[model samples]
Structures are given as structure tokens and as C-alpha cells.
Target chain A: MDKVIKGKVWKFGDDIDTDLITPGKWLGSPELKDHVLETEDPDFPKQVQKGDVIVAGKNFGCGSSRETAPEALLQMGIVATFCESYARIYYRNSIGLGLPPLIVPGVSKEIEKGDEIEFSFETFKLKNLRTGKELQAERIPDFLLEILEGGGQEKILKKKLKQKLKELRAKKE
Target chain B: MVRPMTIAEKILARAAGKEEVKPGEYLIAKIDLLMAHIAAARIVARFMGFPAKVRKVFDPEKVVVLEDHFVPAPTVFAANAQKMIREWAFKQNLKYFYDIKAGICHQILPEKGHVRPGMLIVGTDSHTTTYGAYNAAGTGIGDTDGTVAAALGELWFKVPETIRFVLDGKLPKYVMSKDIILKIAGDYKADVACYKSIEFVGKAAEDMSIASRATLSNFSMELGAKFAFTPPDNKIIDFLKGRTEKPVTSDDLVKPDEKAEIEKIYELDVSDLEPQVACPHTVDNVKPVSELKDVEIQQAFIGSCTNGRLEDLKIAAEILKGHKVHKKTRLLIIPASQEIYKAAIKEGIIETLIDSEAIICNPNCGPCFGAHMGMLAPKENCISASNRNFKGRMGSEDAGIYLASPAVVAASAITGVITDPRTL
Candidate 1:
């Protein structure tokens, strides 16, 4: 994982729930990537470029624990999300899927749409290149950082569990 | 000196094998249950993506897989997903597997005795907080977290601050537990309890039936509660007595100490409470039923993990006993589980609803999420008993959804408009 992330900003407002991110009607559809944030911003999926960042207001990703919410963002080439605050499960899902959901208080106010922002995972520092405004973000826990470092929980769990299986086989031998 | 711990702190402390736990501190805790539904198929697919020949779940007994979200396979895509989930459950030899007959994961988990006090449970669905009604620590998880918890029998948690809501005085006639939560949402708004555990205590909470208490815990998700609890009492014990094969006694009940540290306390007297409704677009945009005028509805749905219990059906039946559903509105009633459906049949509640021209669907999450069954058309308005009134939650983004109790839904169906149950 990179120590710093730099991306173009795609801004959203507070209380942008899972239903808005991934509507319930298209729960299991392959078309989910096309519908990501379609209700809230019809142009999001079509216009969002690779390595873009999502900046949103408080309680972002609030509502359902559908992994599809973050999965859609990841599928659409979103590198990370910066929110004033996050709903607990969405935060976990974002991190588990290898998307960094950085908590930067007043971030929604600091960054504007289309602004290029650079965030340092090491210093928890976020700088708006467009506005020249810098802010200190909340630190991600060391253990969670390890998950992010290992390229998310899926790869880590696969490696760990395979090792466990080998150990079990060795003990039996 | 050790500070007095709230129920969440004590439960997490016990699960983590620690003397105490405080807010903002993180710890790895052993999980008693790992639940997944239609979503488990994704976890299984992700797990199988690994090239390990010895892929095994930590404990099949702790895993619960149910097919409730996309039951009956509304689409070929959903059907294929369900097939994969069924095959994986068979291969894993999971101890707890339900194939759409059981019901929503949250409702059937308690009804079938999977939830126990002081246990830590996680699920792929957000409403898993419903288990907290039994004094268990339950929270929602996503697929990757679910997959890891399925492999390792433990998950990490950041101890959340507790908010204590104390309710006393008698609930007025026709006012249900749904109203209490709606009133709270109206006053405090959603996100007031974000990432916090909310503990409901006091006489009114104790007086609520198990089903009603489940409603309180279930809808707390709308308030952004990571976990919600109504202290266990004789009511919970009695409810679990014959329902669970495992021996559960009153001594196993977990409660907060009198001096437990809570971040906030809210005291409410429910004697004067009215029937509350969460209007369209958001759960917190709530208003008393009497204040909502001329809001005509095209559909009325009474079901979901939130309020689909037999008690809710009985309330709806009582209001619709003799009256016919308005010609302008279509009424759909779904019991939460097969057991609740059977119980409603035995009690003649189903017959009364059927006589009123209400459509009774199978016990699944019917149309609450707009996945299947009764979806609202463009510009249509629906008064529903299910939680969540988020925009586009129940089909057409232009459609409006008003959330209320079963009685209100039934009464509104009869009048073709949002009506106070007492007026019916």
C-alpha cells in the first residue's frame, strides 16, 4: 500500500446512505458498477475517472451493511473516501475491501469538487492542492493499518488460513 | 480502580477475556455466532478464490446461512447466487442452514434459539443488531469481515460508548413500540447514536413483549446504533423457555451496573405518546400520525424484520377485521417467519387480513427493500410497517414511503390515506 494517496475529488453531501450508493433494486446485478451513486449523482459512475477520491459530509455511507456499497466505489476506480464521519459498518467494509476511508473533520468543507488532494497515511496529513489548505486527519489504528498494508483482509486471510491448514496437516503427520 | 461497565462493555470484556473494556479501546473478541444470508455466497466465492485445498470454516456450528433477502429467486442472477450458497452450506456441513422457509435472519435467529445473553454475534446484514434484544452484543459486518470471522472464530471491535434511554409511564392505547423508536428518531434525529450502543431500560421497556422489544432493537439500526439492548428480564426468559432447546436461566441475563459509565442519558415518559410516523426520504423526518394530513397512499405493507412478528400481524388483523381495504390502495401483509405465519393462521389473523382483501406473501423480506414482491410505482405513496424510509428504498425513487406501526398501516390501508389507528 502507498503511504500517500493523491486523487481528483468527487464530492457528496451528508447522510449519503447505501441505498443511494447502491440501490436495493440492483442488489446482485453486474450492472451495479453502472448504478453506483446513480440516484444521488446520475453522472458519478459515468464521469468518475480512475484514481478519483470521494469526499463527503458527515454520516457518509450510512445505512445497510451491503458490501456492494463500497464494492461499487472500488469497482468504479475510487481509490479512497474522505468523510467528515462514517457509519461504523461502512467504514469496516471500506477498509476490509482495501479502500481507505479517511476521517478528516470538516473535510467536506476543505475540499471542493474536482480539487486534487494528497493524503499521507504516515502523518495523517491531508492537503488540498487546489486550495493550499492542509488538515490533520484521525489516525487509523495500527492493526487496521496492517490490514491495509497487507492489501486488505481477503489476501491476508487467505494466506493465514492456508498456513493454518499446513500446520494442521503437519501436526497430523 | 475499575469503573463500572455498561452491558456492552461487560459483554465485550468477557468475550475478549479482559477484566474491563472502555470506549475508544480496541480488542479482539471471540464471536459466538457468524451469520450470513444471500450475501454469504459472496464470501464463499471469495474464500474459494484462494487455491488452498484445505479450506475449512472455523466452526460450522457458529455459522448461520439463510436465504431470505432474495428468496424465491426473483431473477436468474439471484437464483444462481442462492444455488451457490446452498451448495457451499452442504459442502461446509453447516449446522444452521435455512432455505427461505425459516424467514429473515434477524427474526428467526431469536425464534430458533441461536441468540443468547452476553454472546457476541456478527452478520452480513445491518439489522443483526436485532439480537441485542436478548442482551447479546451484535453488530453488522461486510463480506470480507464475515469471511475472516468465518475462518477465525474471532473479530476485532472498538468498544463503543453507551447511551442509556430510560422510558417510564404506560404507553397509551394503540401506541406500539414502533412509535417509541419513531418518537426518539423524531426528537434526536438519525446519527444521534452513531457508532454507539443504546441501552433501553426502565418500566416501559420491561413491560414490552419480546416481539416489541425486538422492534426496539431492530429499528435502532436506523438511528445508527452499532448495538442496541433492552435489558433482559423475566419476559425474555419466559420467551426463550420452550423456544430454545439449550437451557437458559434467569441468572444468565446480563444487565448494566447501576453505576455503569454511559455517555448520555435520555428520560422519556410514554404516557402521553402518540402514534408516530417517519415520513419519506429519511427515517428521522418523523411526525405524529395526526399531524400528517391528506397524504394519500397507494400501497400499505406490513412486514419485515423490524415489525413482522405475530404480534404485529395480530394488531393489523384487529384493525382490519371487518373493514375492507380501500379500492384506491393495495395492502400486502407478510409475516416475518414461517412460525409467525403459522401462529397467525391459528389465531385467525391471516383469515381476517385475507377477508379484508390483503395480499399475504410468504415470510421473507418482501418489498421492504424493493428487491421483490410489492414494489411501489412512480409517484406512488406507501405506508409501511417496515423500517427505512430512505429515498428509493422501496422501488421508484419518485415514490414516497411513510413508516408506521402495523395498526397504522392497517388503518391507513382501509382509509387509503395515512390515518391514526385510534381513529379507525
Candidate 2:
């Protein structure tokens, strides 16, 4: 059983760089507990809900492949991200941190702020709870689905390595 | 009605056993190159913790290690991070190595001929897209993905469909890759291509040198593209001439298949374009320098892998030749590497810059990141050739940063606000 929590959407245009996500100046400080709240614009992180899904336009993480960008999102308790597109480094960082980055086509045009939506990520669809209009996303590939199920790339490697070790021991026996 | 496959699609389809890969389609391909930064220390520690059995050199010749970022550490933390990377390189026996005294990884990688056209490149740093100038499909990866690529020279990629950018005409006199990319950034406002690869074609791309084209493809990541590229031609062949020991002939050249499909097409004519600036708070918040002219700057940094090449230095020196940098503005010029520095000195580009009162630093990614020497005070503003202008990204959250081309940075060092290099 999973929980879906929706809030008033805050739409940010594409190419939201890692610098804005987690400023390097903050890296000087050792504190990792909700540093997102202290961003130049304080309202952004606070407006987000614990389980809220961020819907972005494109190139969502661009410039400076620092891990702090996704770390800030996770620290804010953001459960998933639905973007029309994402930067290569940013997408991998989010997935590595066990955050779902759903690639939806043309979803940025359909949704507006204050739209009450029901997102069934398991089914890969977003429904307007008030209007009952469902938006479908193109199917995510099986390998990515497997990584998502196995808890990201790092975890998948761990599981594979473990299985390989077991097989090697059995062969020796 | 016929839909022609884009150049990117044609290349990817040739490699892809499967028919088509749309935007969301995740098709895996064998990685061609693996690049890592100093953070490789942590990745090495992970491998040591859980050693992979029967591991020799995973793509030994293809892997490149560079200590570019976090150089000249001001604090003990950065020093330790550098130490970790040094120890790992020794244990891994990496062949292509660039230490802290060297320069930015992206600049070093291609200058040394590690980047090749049609090759898929992955780096630990995000700006790895800079290598796309060599016509390689390059992108950034995190520590985990990097470590995996180090252990197994392969990582899965969903061959990205291409967005064909057909350049309509030539650029204006002062307009360079920075303006073209910034104009494109404004056209799309950050989300246009998102996860797609952008392929630059037509006369505009052909006319630009590999370094200028590198700036365009490099910052394409700034527009949310997975990566961007321009196929190598005689220019790339010329660049790779002496740099590569193994002569790569055109016979082995990989070209796009004729029967491929393109996802979308974008066209732009940058003729008569002006110098652009990404104002503070966001790279996407772009505007021409004329729009926000006379905004005082405390610093003017003219280097980074982004704009630290010899051409960039020449452009800056040309502007700063006889003129002195503004009294309040500290003009810092760092070459991409010792090689570029030596070339600039040999060509008298260094004397021209020094005569203009510009502070010439060593070849490294120093103050562009604001880690050690160039940290800003609150309310300070900087005009920089480095990428990204997010709030507090350079030094202080209150510090305002304007991203510009090397020409603009040098010109601004003269006038002290965002000034167009052409006007000067």
C-alpha cells in the first residue's frame, strides 16, 4: 500500500540548475538537515509537501553535477518527480537516491497550479481528482522499471554481486 | 508524407538493435568512454568494500581521471577529498591522469585527445557535455554510476532521439557560442529539449571552430538537453592531428544512417545577435547585456573549462589589449591548462592580458566555483565566463552573478557592469 499526497503545484521552467537546487556556499556548512529551506527564495522548499510530486518542464537538473540538488529534494520529503524531461546527471542522481523520475510527454501543458490531481505512479498516470481527467505517460522501459523495483542502480549492483558470489560458492562445492 | 530520421536517430539506430527510441524509451547501449573526477576516491572505497571478482582494467585505455574541481582547497575537507582521489588513481592504475595542478577535466580531456566523435562519454561532473564539441555523445553521471562504469566499462543508455537544430545563417561579429546557446535558452526557456539530445547542423555550426562549438554543446546541458553535439569534420581532424598517437582515419568514421527518424527540428539565425547574460538566480533568466547595463561588478573571472581555451584567451586579450581593467573589478584570467597557458604566452596573449592589469592565475578551475580564492562578499556581483549563475552559487547567496562569454567578461572588467564586448 502506497500513499499519494497532492498539493498546489509550483511550476518551475526547465533547466533548473544544481546551483539553485543546492547552492555550493551551503556545502561549506556541514549541516544537511533541511538546508533546502534556506535557499535564497525560502518559499520554494516550504511550499512543497512531504509526498508532493514535482512536475517540471525540461532539463530539470542542468549544470554542475553535484549530488546536493537531489539531496535537497529528498531532504524536503519530496517523494517523486514528473518532468517532461531531465538532464542526464540529474536523472541518474534522483534514481540513485531512490526517487522516481517519471518521464511524461506533454504533461506540462495539461496541468495548472491549484489543480487537484491523483497520481498513480504504479499505473503511470495522473488524474485530475476534481475533473476526473486522467493523463497517461508513455511506458517506462523494463530495465529502468527493474532498477526502480530493485531500489536504484547501486542497490541492483549490490544484489547482482551477492547473487554472483552465491553462484561462485555453489560451483566450488 | 515522409519524416526523415534525424542525424542523432540515424547514429543511435545503427547502434540500437531495437527499431525506434522515442523520448521516454530507455534503450541501453555499450558505453564508449568513462570519465571521472577527484570524487573517484569515494568510488574506489566502495569497490574496496565490496570487491568485484576477477577484475582487470575495465576499459583501462578509455577511462580518464582528472583532479580539476576542488583544487587549492581552502579547508581541510577539500584537502582530504583531493587526497582520496590521488590514492585511488594509484590503486586503479589509470593511464590518462590530470592532477590538481593541471586544469578543468572537460578542457583537459579533449585537449589531450581523449574525446572522439561518435563516442559515448560519461563523466562524474555534469559539465562533461563540454566534450560534445568533438562530436561525442557526452553526459554527466553521479558517483555510483561512475563507479559502476569504472568497474564495468559499460552502462546502459536509452539511445536518445535527436532534436535537429538547423542553423539558418551565420552569427554576428561578436556573437559566439555563448550567445547562440543563451538565445536558444531563451527560445526554449530551459524546458524545450529537456532529456533529448540536440544536434547542431548547417552552415553556422560548420563555420564555428571546435572550441566555439564546444561552448555551445557544453552549455546545451544548461538548456535541459541530455547533451548536444556537432559531428566532427576537418576541423576536428585538424585538432586531433598531433594530439592522438593512433591516426584515426575517415574509414572508421561513424556517420548517421540515411534512413533514420528525427523527433523534432529547431532553427535559429544568430546573425546580428548581441552578447547575452544569464542574470543572477537562474541560468534560464537570461537577457542581453544591454538590457541590464551598468550593473556594477566586483569581480570579472575569465576562465573555466567552459571558456579557458586559447581562443577564449585571445578574445579576452583582444578586448583588454591597451585598456586597463576597472579599478574596483578584479580581472582573473586562468588558462584551461599549462599547455594552453604556454601557447598563450608564446603567442603574447599573456602579455596583452597582463598589460591590461588582469591578474593571470595558474591553469586550473580556481575561482569559477568560489571554493577557495574567489569567494565573494555579501551583495557582491561578478561577471564570469563560467557556467551557472544560481543564487549564492559563486560565493554568497546575496552575491549576484552574471554568466557571460570570455569577451564579455574581459570587456566588463574594463567597464565593470555587464557590457557587450563588441560595443567596446
Candidate 3:
């Protein structure tokens, strides 16, 4: 997780579903973003640069249990996604995959396309470098934060596996 | 006296090992049951890789794997994915792995009593909320989160706010649970409860059969509800009594507090409502079936976790008893579970459906989400009982799917157009 992230914003509208991010039909493709946001913005995958922040309206990533939705965005160098709210499964997917998707309620009203916004998901605050407006974002639970900081579930699992094994042995004793 | 707990609060608190939980509280709750579909089990297994988190499952009794989506493998790719799940389940010594034989996970879980009242359940498939029909707090999770639950017996959750939907009156004769939910979905919008849970209450909800209640909870996904549940009733209690080893009692039931922390309440009276349909591309684009009577359909499908229960099949059978499908349209029926298949067979629902020139396949998702069987060609139209009518969902992106209930689909299959079941 980046302590501070600064990037150009890519704005999306309400209910940006997993199909738009990583359609199930195209799940295994290497060029994931090839069809990413193709439903809404056909030009997104081609023009999206590294270190970009995607700010979306309500219920971002609504359908399916596709972790590839966030993995594709992260692999394409999306540093963060700020939305009014998120689908429950997608929110967990983002955290487990180490994508910084913060819920800053009304950031959508304050930020615009191509605006320069600086924020840290851990800090739970954002500064609009362009408009000089500051926004407060929702803070996540510590356990989830730990997973994000460790870079994903795999890294966290690597450590927990050893600990869990010890606990199992201790239980037997 | 202890504060009466909402079903969701009660289940979450019990799972989290807490006395009480607030609406927005976050906690790590233990999963009593975690279901994995082949769609996600294979993905999670692949991502974990190598020797993985454990050689065998952390707890075999608490996990289930169902191969419903592309069963019998619509394509070689799907078969290989199923192979991976089969191999992993066998190696992990998982207790319940219903390969293509079992049918959809949602229908099977309840059929097998895997879901019970006041439990914290999770599934890889989004419609896992289907268990909520039994008064459990179950929601969908992705493969990554599901993998964690599989490795450990627990997962974290931000307790979702609750919205109570009170149904005040009985549904009209032609209208079904599908119509009621479609009306709600359209009125509330797909994002109504984006990250929240919705509870169905009142006399109508209590009066509904376990199967009918499932239709309401299953379509909660169409509204993006984290979960949808009804307070346990006699049907649920009776269903669980025979299934569980323990002597069950009312103490196992959960109910909402008089002052439960509900975000909002939406009261609906359905005595006068008509059968509804959600048109293509969006679940919220709903309209009355009568208004869309001119819309012609080339296909009609009845079966999915949403409306493929024995009762649903019986309704369709009643409509198709002496009639044949229209020449221009094809009708397909895929039972939601093998148990449903047997029950429908015993009741002669299959004979009626088959004698009516309907194509009944094994219990599988069956083109519900474009995975396999009975695909639609370009510009073709379908009226289906499945949940979603999303664009390009069934087959070709150019095809259109209109969602209705089983009876409605059966009637429309005979008409080759959208026809309200009331007309029958």
C-alpha cells in the first residue's frame, strides 16, 4: 500500500460492475484492460496511464466474484479507486489483492476527470491538488489494513500458515 | 430481558463471538458453512498454488463444493477447471463435493440442510444470499476471500446496515415471488442496498413457502443487496429438524428487535400488483408483462436458483399440461438441483414439460449466465425465469433476455411472445 498516492483521476459513473472492469468471458486474457471499462469507456484501457486513480459513483464492481476485476486494474498500474461505496465482495477483493480502493463519500462531487488528487488510504484523507479541496475518507479495519500492507492475502497467508500451525500444535498439547 | 436481535445481528454476533454488533461494526466472524462453486474454487486453488495453505481442509464438515455452472463442461476449458476442483477437493478431503451431478449450489445447500438459522454462511457465488431464506446471515465473497475462509474457518465483514421490507398483502393469482421482487428491484434500483442487507417481513413473508422465500432472497443480488433474509417459519424449522442431528427448538430461531437499528423501512402492498418483467441489459428496467405483450421471444427458459424449485416447476407444469410450445419458440427447463429433478419427476412435472415439447436438461446453470446449453443466436429474444437479463449474458451480445417467473415463461413459450400467466 502506498503511504501517499498522487495521480490523475479517471472518473466513472454509478454501478460500475465487474463485467465492465473484467468481463467474465475475458477473465484469463493477459491484456486484461484490453476490454476493461469497454462498456462505458472503450478508450480507457488504451489511454490509462500508470499511477492513475479511478473515482467512481455508487456500488462499484456490482456483479460476480471476479478478483480479476481488481487484479486487472492493479496490473495496469491503478494506484487507487475512490468510490461513494462498493459491492461487498469487490471491496474484499480489492483489499486481499492490495488495491487501495477508499470510500470517500461525496468525493465524486468534489473531484473531476483528470484532476490531480493526492491521498493516502491509510491516512483516510485526500487533498485535491488542483482545487485545493480536502476530503475525508472512511478508515478500514486494522486487520484488513494489515493484509493490504503485506501486499496481498498470499503474503499474509505465508506468515499466518506458520502461526496457525504452531497454534494447532499448542492446542493438541 | 435481552434485546431481541435482528436475524443478521444475531447470526453475526454469534459468529464473531460478541454479545452484540452495531450496524457498521467490523468483525471477524467464523463461517459455519462456506460454499464454493467450480467457477471460483478452481481460481482460488490456482492462485494459492503449490502445496497451498493446508494439505487437507481446515474443517471438512464446514465446507462444500458444487459444480453447477458449466457442468459436464460446456467447453474443454471448463472441463479442465472442473478437473482442478475435483482433484483439489479429493486431496483436501472435503466432505461435500457435488460434481456436475448435484446442480446449483444455492438450491443444494438448503436441500441438504447445510444452511441453518442463526448461522454465518459464505459462498463464492454472489447469490449465496439464497441461504438467507433460512434466517442465516450469508453473503457472496470472491475467490480470494473465499480461499481465506476455506483455509481458516472464518472471514471478516463490515456489518451491513439493514433495510426492512414489509409486505402487507397477498400476491395476486398470476403474480409470483419473482414478480414481487422484480417490482421491488425496479422501485429500489439495482443499487438500493449496494452494501447493505435487506430483510423481508410481515404476514406475506411468513406465509411464503421455503421455496418461494428463496426466490425473494435469490433476486437480492439483482438489487445488489449484501444479503436478504426472512425470519424463520414452520417450513424452515420443519426442513431443518429432519436434516440436523440435534434436537432443534425455538431457541435456535432469530427475530428482529422492536428497536433494531434499521436504516430504512419500505412497506409494499401487493394485492393489486401485476406480473412484472425486467427487460434486457438491466435488472432494474422492469415493467408489467401486459404492457410488454407485443414483445416476441424465440426462447423460454425455466430454472435457476431464483425460480427452479419444485413449486416453481409445478406451476410451469400446470400451465403446460395440455399445451405445446409455439413452433417459433424453444422452451428449456434445467432443474436447480438433483433433488428438485427427482421431486419434479415424481410429480410428473417433467412429463408435462417434456410432452409439451420442452427440452429438459440435467441440473445445471444451463445458459443462465451464458456458460452452456441452449444459447441464443444474434437478435434472438428470450423470456426466462433466471435472475439476470443483462446484455450479452445468455449468448450473443445482440440477443435480448427478459426475466419473468416460471409460469410466465411457460405460458410465453406456448405463445411465442411475452404473455402474462393471468391470460392462461
Name the lDDT of candidate 3.
Answer: 0.83
- Identify the runs in model 2 with alpha carbons over 4 angstroms from their true place: A1-16, A40-59, A75-77, A82-85, A103-119, A125-139, A166-173, B1-7, B10-24, B52-57
DockQ of the two-chain complex in candidate 1 = 0.76
Give the per-residue lDDT digits (tens) of candidate 3, residues B1-424.
5555666888888889989887778898888988988755554554455354344456988888878887788677787888888887787777787777888899888777787778888888889888888888788887777777777778888888889899978987767889889999889888887778889998788888888899999889768788899767667888777766564567777777788888999999988989999998788889988789479999999998898889888999899989999999999998888988998999888999999999999998887877478778999999999987766678776889999989899999998989988787
Q: What DockQ does candidate 3 have relative to the true complex?
A: 0.48
What's the CA error at residue B230 for candidate 2, in Å?
A: 1.6
Flag clash pairs in model 3. none
Better of 2 and 3 by TM-score: 3
* List of chain B TM-scores, one per candidate: 0.99, 0.93, 0.96
Residues B1-424 of candidate 1 have per-residue lDDT tens digits of 7789999999999999999989989999999899999789888898787656656788999998998986788888888899999999999999989977798889888888888888899999999888888888889999899998998888889999999899999998789999999999999988989999999999999899989999999999989899999977877777777777686888889988889989999999999999999998889999999999999999999999999999999999999999999999999998999999999999999999999999999989989988788888999999999998888899999999999999899999999999998986
Best by DockQ: 1
Per-prediction DockQ: 0.76, 0.49, 0.48
Error of 3 at A123 (Å): 5.1
Model 1 off-target regions past 4 Å? none
lDDT of 3 at B85: 86
TM-score of each: 0.98, 0.88, 0.93
| Docking class for candidate 1 | medium
Order of candidate numbers by lDDT, starting with the best: 1, 3, 2
Cα lDDT tens digits, model 1, A32-141, are: 77888888778888899889999999888888998899988998889999999999899999889889989999898889888999999989999999989998899999
- Candidate 1 chain B, poorest ten consecutive residues by summed lDDT: B47-56
CA lDDT scores, all candidates in order: 0.90, 0.74, 0.83
